[model samples]
Target: MTMESATDAAPLRTQTVAVKSSFYLAMRILEPARRDAMYAIYAFCRAVDDIADDEGDRAQRREALDQWRYDLDELYAGRIRPRSAFLAGPVRRFGLDRADFEAIIDGMAMDVEEDICAPDWEKLELYCDRVASAVGRLSVRAFGLVDDGAKELPTAPKLLAYHLGRALQLTNILRDLDEDAARGRLYLPREALEEAGVSNHAPHAVLANPALDQVCAPVMSRAREHFEQADLVMAGLSKNAVKAPYLMAAGYRSILDGLTARGFAPPRAPVRMSRRKLVGALLRHAFL
Candidate 1:
């Protein structure tokens, strides 16, 4: 089969529909071909992430992640077939490369091994690479970008995906800082804030401290860097793939802007996009 044919299989659309309703709704803004691969990757990623984020026995989460990894190994090896449930069918029907799927599993497993918040920037990047970047790389595969020999091209897309993931994660941090800290997780790097001469020692400090903006200046700067990096990557992708990420970026950028406008307060309100905004994104994807 031709490269385009392989990437554009109709099964991808069916898989997109089978994913979690919210994700499927968000991804529907993407072109059908792009949406398909995105759905399959997201379905797997969501499953792994749920294991980490879900409220349950810690031992149960660890056990579930272990089983997930094992299932991933089996799926890649074609040892035991995955039943056509949720988003599994698209991955099989599209012949998505196993490497991207494994990377996602690797990233989720990393999250399960420790706290959601890491102590350093290096660890944060590692986390972003595994969780978010891995999905982006899989997206590149679905977009039909391949090497000279028809194998998937990896490096450029990998870097691009990594930054986009970082930007999204940073947005998550800003939006959920309070909630995460309450759970004994602080995603903000202590070193970075100290270097900026701002304190964030307590769960409510982000909302309580008068110097909140000062403390967040450095963190926002870092988020801006990742945001810029994501913009560069957006320019590099095909038109079809760009729309979904662009919409995703718009929402994130709004959070950053909203944080600045609110004096960098940790989210006191739910972060959301209005229906009008969602519709605008849908129209843009359809017409532009």
Candidate 2:
């Protein structure tokens, strides 16, 4: 549904408060309009991710995800409900399209299958497309680039969105390796690791082996490719459009740098960019 359909709905103060408190600091780097839009987008994503990662019986989690998908379908059909009382404004303000939100649902649904594998390259790409690329699409909308009237390559924004998504997804895979392993989730493909003489079956063996560096090198290299693509995508956007993504890219790249410094070892804690660094990047982008 378009932005015009929900102009009359009551303001989403409670929802906005939660989203702003949670995501607003980083989002504040964005153009005011885009920042407002991003609150909606992030809230929607955070909600879905919480369902997938939160404590619950596997079946219960799956049911919640399924219900989320149904809510997504209804939202698209203009039957919007205040699920969290925080989503209405940003969703309406940004005029986010239904498909972008649904793609998130599709990605979360993958978690319910209970068989996390080291996906082949093709499968991994598809997974990234849904989970990460979809987020990028939503970001494009937040950046107010929907229906960009271009004479050629109308998909530049979409490509940028996908690249951003892929880069972040890769960062997550690396950062969560230890935790994911304990939970029986392996994101790095078995074939690639095996080719480098690493074993997914014995994750600790691979971690202990010096050859694990070899295994991570290719994955990091590919992640860099996507990162470069995302950079190119940013180059084609308005300066305002580039700000939030630039910070996000820099944050992800910092994690990559940290991984490289650790000889590509998995992180013991969540990899995060300092607030100072994040704000510094935005200030540079804003004034430069």
| Residue 264 Cα positional deviation in candidate 1, in Å, after optimal superposition | 3.2
Q: What number of backbone clashes does candidate 1 have, counting pairs of residues 3 or more apart or in separate chains?
A: 0
Question: What is the lDDT of every predicted structure here?
Answer: 0.63, 0.69
Q: What local lDDT score does residue 138 receive in model 2, on the 0 to 100 scale?
A: 73
TM-score against truth, every candidate = 0.78, 0.83
10 residues in a row with least lDDT, candidate 1: 1-10
Model 1 C-alpha lDDT per residue in residues 1-288, reported as the tens digit of each score: 222223334445456444644335556655565566566666667667778776677778889877876776655554543432334444554556667666777776665666655367777777667677667666655554433223455666666677777777777777777777666566777666676555555555545666666666767787889889878866776756566666776667777777776665544566554455656766776676
Candidate 1 TM-score to native: 0.78
What lDDT does candidate 1 reach at residue 236?
A: 71
Q: When superposed on Cα atoms, how far off is each prediction in RMSD?
A: 4.8, 3.7
Q: Total clashing residue pairs per candidate?
A: 0, 2
Q: Candidate 1's C-alpha lDDT?
A: 0.63
- How does candidate 2 score on lDDT? 0.69
Model 2 is weakest, by summed lDDT over 10 consecutive residues, at: 6-15
